[model samples]
Target: MDALIEKLKGQIIEQLNLVEVKPADIKPDAPLFGEGLGLDSIDALELIVLLEKHYGIKIQNPADGKKIFESVRTMAEFIKSNGKD
Candidate 1:
């Protein structure tokens, strides 16, 4: 789980082109939107693509995205449950 979290941080930074952010900057349990990472809807779309492209995981429901993308930890958890490690 720790390895997955670490890999997720790197993938998110690279996929989103977040050059100013590093893996350490992303707290696993911190919210990824609004007050946390300050990500918006566009970033959400990129995240979906990131999941599919990297993890071969497709989000079956759009509503679940709110929960799945709640934080880095949540994303990792979702991937672990629905896709590869």
Candidate 2:
């Protein structure tokens, strides 16, 4: 799933328009929201849509989303384990 992490990192950075931050800069354990990346609700929505669009997986509930989106590692695992692609 290393390739999936790389791709997700790239997508996150790209979709969020995070200037000056490369995909390599993001740590797998670093939280994507709150104090870690300072991302907000909108960013979370973007990420959810991104996952669905790219991985063919639909996050039906926001509660589950929080668990799956805890970090880069979590997101990659979530997508890989739950994604249809």
RMSD of every candidate to native, in Å, equals: 1.0, 1.3
Steric overlap count per candidate: 0, 0
Q: For residue 32, what is the lDDT in candidate 2?
A: 83
Error of 2 at 25 (Å): 1.5
lDDT of 2 by residue, 1-85 (tens): 7888888898888888888888878998888878857789989888888887888787788778788889989999987677443
TM-score of 2: 0.89
Candidate 1, residues 1-85, lDDT tens digits: the string is 9999999999999988888998999999988987856678889989999999999998778778999999999999998898588
**Poorest lDDT segment (10 consecutive residues) of candidate 2:** 76-85
Looking at model 2, the pairs that clash are none
Name the top TM-score candidate.
Answer: 1
Q: Following a full C-alpha superposition, what root-mean-square deviation does model 1 have from the true structure?
A: 1.0
lDDT against the true structure, each candidate:
0.90, 0.83
- In order of appearance, the predictions have TM-scores of 0.93, 0.89
Q: Residue 51 lDDT in model 1?
A: 96
lDDT of 1: 0.90
